[model samples]
Target chain A: MDTTVVNTGAEEKTWGGGNKPLNASYGKMMMWFFIVSDALTFSGFLAAYGFSRFKFIDYWPIADEVFTHVPFVHGNYPMIYVAFMTFILIMSSVTMVLAVDAGHHMNKAKVTLYMFLTIIGGLIFVGSQAWEWATFIKGDFGAVETRGGNILQFVDAEGKRVALSDFVVAGEHERVEHESKNGLWFVDEGTLPTYTMQEVITGFESHPDLAIRTQTINEQGHKTVLSREESIKQLKANGIGIVEGANLRHNEYGTPLFADFFFFITGFHGFHVFSGVVINIIIFFNVILGTYERRGSYEMVEKVGLYWHFVDLVWVFVFTFFYLV
Target chain B: MAHAHKLEILRGLIKFKSNTQKIWGVLILLSIITAVEVVLGIYKPESLMAHVLGMKALNWIFIILTIVKAYYITWDFMHMRDEKASLRRMVVWTAIFLIAYLLFILLQEGDYIESVYSSGFVKKDF
Candidate 1:
């Protein structure tokens, strides 16, 4: 008596177990879910960055000033190189979508070509990021860290940045960097900076055209540049250590927090790009071997394309928040 | 299966012949937006520097343009528009709501901390 089946047609409903309510395959839907969660992770990082930046609004380092170097050409070309990197990543996203479109059409040759191009574009972008990081670590102009944990840069009378090597005269005093072999058995000091505090102060005293630029931003939206007399006084009173480039512990640009966020956010994003490239390469070989072609659907390419485009999307935000805003 | 794409962007103001064409169209749009952002960032016009809603107008523009670019990348490149409405809302709405809420709370707290640092009796020298 209980064996009779009901004709309610539950399977025909959108929410029924057999129906694809989202009009997407299980694998595709899972990819989307992963992307959604990944997006949240990235937003968390960016939001934390914003919080730190807002906390130090008055002395936050300007993005334009921090990223000013080009590959070959130099001389204060701010935002140029980063703009180039953005374009490269966007162009690669285009190639990725095109690969997906070709996959939809089951066009093996086009997918291969476009996937190759996308991989190349990703490589170029990752290489550029590495170059940018190298340049940032190898700073051009050096500065001094005050006793109060603030940065003090140098500028000329015209308010142009001056490198420490330009005027710092080496002194006769000899000092050795602490090493594990010589100093405390377990404690070791970091690499010594190029110039000493005394050397910088002496050089700055002789150059009347030079000035001290503090990390504080004035009402005019620039670093507060002290006069010659004030520069001497501040350097003598507060200058405690020399800081030449950027590291996790210190930064010549401004607060150490700026470099920390820059490395963390961009480093995380760069790792994403790298893994995307590896995935693209794997799919590239699969396409070459006709794996998807034999499966009667190139959906594998589409899934990977979704991942690739997600990477590009994250870069767009990183570019805006880190570079533009 | 061949998927049909909604071959138009900008609320159908621009139409493309095919999905491939649409991809190129969105790329161009993204590029133009990026270029505009870079230009504004470089110049930082005195007019736009004025605070509009507790932020520089220029920064507001950059954030808005960035959202526009993100929309196209998701809608066009990721084929969000071709998917069913249920899927679309599931992905976009969730991320948007969560990120907005997080940003608001964090930024407000950060501003409060800044005020404390500037005005409170806590000694900064230490």
Candidate 2:
């Protein structure tokens, strides 16, 4: 009968709970733990990217030059679209927080609406990322790859970039298509670049105002621009072929590793956003069904909110590391 | 500790009436920081381009602003501000220490490789 006596101590009361650890729900605590591990994984990728960037410090591609294109626009607008993407993601994170707040208030309708907006934002971000990938793969100004595996770009006397189509003159040459009927059926030519090395060289020889821009970043943090004489000499001596856009083996931007890291990092992040959208849709339906209303708490929304916010946080770093720096 | 929320951000400089208001406040802060970053990146002022610790001064600004944004997103949007101290420390400290260590090792190796290319026998251009 005396066992009902008052008892209070840190050790006895601390580990007594089965669900709440440190006063946080088990799900929330687990989500935070998972996020820490995932953050390390992302940082590892980004750090390796940094290592490669530093290794090729002088010859690394200028991110502004590479990511200049905006969707449905023809002119050169550097970093504008990526900036828009970042804003959209941040807005989504805001909406996600709103949903979680509404959950705390037990407002099912508000939570549903905010969740819908967050889903829309996620979709837009994923789509924008896809468009960016396509634009990067289909490059702006084509460049020539040297025998030493270097990228050599073309520029006008004013230092504006010149596309291959602007200068490469077409020559009349009868060529057989590399079809399965002509060549080995098992292996066919993997599409040819618009212009050959000879055509580019010949075009360079004709254009007096054109010069070559090496991938090497000069003292002013711009690509090194060579004179007409040096351009012609370099092209004739080392130019092997033309690289139209980015691929695993070659990239018109600069080093192939640049394209490689860009693809891997952004692709991974896009995949996360894609899955986040899918999860949001599921949670949206659950909220519409009033599942949490019956359970008397909206802890599920809080859990997913953690994930969405984590995605946004990672993008903040990615945006800084890749685009700005 | 029991009933009231620990959600007020900015070290109590600007306390929010509700979590929704706090979310909007964070959004505005993040947007302003992003705007500053984009402007600095686009203009790349000559003074900010001066090298500092093997990186541009402007770049250092970007990284710092990025960390600030990350903090707001975590503390406010993710509700980490309301989290218990143990949980917060467990997540934040682990990430910070590990990422710092990783960056140190990887960057040092990268510098070594660069030295090899410049002063050592290895040549980059064939």
Candidate 3:
């Protein structure tokens, strides 16, 4: 006797049971949900940032002052560079939307082109973030100097802040002596960077004229507008290194927290964009080879389109919070 | 899962548009809104720039406009609006609840931390 077997798929069991109005696959719907959850996660991080801002309202670093440096420009520039980055990501989202449109029309070439542009846009945004990070970590106005071999900062005389460099002078670069390679105890054995924290300290000591400004001081503490006697006294004090977490406040270049979140969240998102690009390339090849035309539809593009747009949607919020707000 | 494939998906760009003109119209409107937001952010007009309800005014506007854009991206661009109400509800409602919960908890916690800070709980000077 012969038996007949039924191959009814999960779709039969109401992965979306009947009475479902829109038709979408389990995966696409799930993608949307994942994006929603992820969006909340990002918002959580940002909200925490805002809360932190309120706590540190007085000494919070000015965004414009901190982020004034621009590539290829000798002097300072405001948020122009990052603003351009925001535009790039948004435009890329538009292109992704258009790619999804092309997918709907069965226009593979247009989809591939738009997808490539989106990938390029993502790469540029990531690069901009990297540049911002480097500028931040290196810090403008340089590090401050302190009497206790620590660096410090404060609000300047003009009611604006200034770096310790405003008070101190950097010593000439000098190498510290260590035991010879053949006789030294193994101390990680790695080569040292040209400048060590110790070298920075020595530089501070040599420049005694640098004033000691506590991180607790306001912007009114750093300017040369003081009375002649006070200016000379400020000139006579030693400089200190910048305080810990000075690199992490809401400051001249926007908030360092802004940089931090922009990097972390956008980095995570960029990873998605990078991964999406790789997947799009794979899909592009299949489309080019007429795989979908033979199989009969281009729903894959639409599915990915949702992910692309979600990334863009998240960026809009990130951009607003970090740059605008 | 088969529908998950790009080849199997539908091109939704303007499939439901009453006309091509309407599609362009929506696109332009979205663009204008974005421009307004960007400009407002840069200039920080007094009317909309001050803090509202304790939060920064710019922040409020950004959050509101961002939510609006998210809605359009979902409903219009992604065509989630055309989806079954159950499906739409699952996505939209869950996000609404989750986001609301997240914002409330984090903001409150943040404020608590700020209060602690103001109370001199965490010493700034080393």
Candidate closest to the true structure, highest TM-score: 1
* Local accuracy of candidate 3 as per-residue lDDT tens digits, A259-296: 56655765676676677667767766777787776766
TM-score of each model, in listed order: 0.95, 0.94, 0.74
Task: List, residue by residue over A1-325, the lDDT tens digit for candidate 1.
Answer: 7687655468777565566768898989999999999999999999999999889888899889889999988688999999999999999999999999999899999999999999999999999999999999998799999888899999998999999999998666556667667768787565667778989998998888999999888998999998888889889988899998899989999999999999999999999999999999999999999999999999998899999999999999999999988
Please, what are the lDDT tens digits per residue for candidate 1 over residues B4-112? 8898888889999988888888888999999999999999999998999788899899999999999999999999999999999999999999999999999999898
| Chain A of model 3 scored by TM-score | 0.70
lDDT of 2 by residue, A21-71 (tens): 688877888898899999999999999999998888889999999998888
In model 3, the runs with Cα more than 4 Å from the true position are A1-6, A9-22, A145-169, A178-262, B1-27, B46-49
**Best candidate, lDDT:** 1
Candidate 2 chain A, poorest ten consecutive residues by summed lDDT: A5-14
Ten residues in sequence with the least summed lDDT for candidate 1 chain A: A171-180
Question: Whose lDDT is higher: candidate 1's or candidate 3's?
Answer: 1
Whole-model lDDT, model 2: 0.90
Docking quality category of candidate 1 according to DockQ thresholds:
medium
Docking quality category of candidate 3 according to DockQ thresholds:
acceptable
List the pairs of residues colliding in candidate 1: none
- What DockQ do the predictions score, one after another? 0.77, 0.68, 0.36
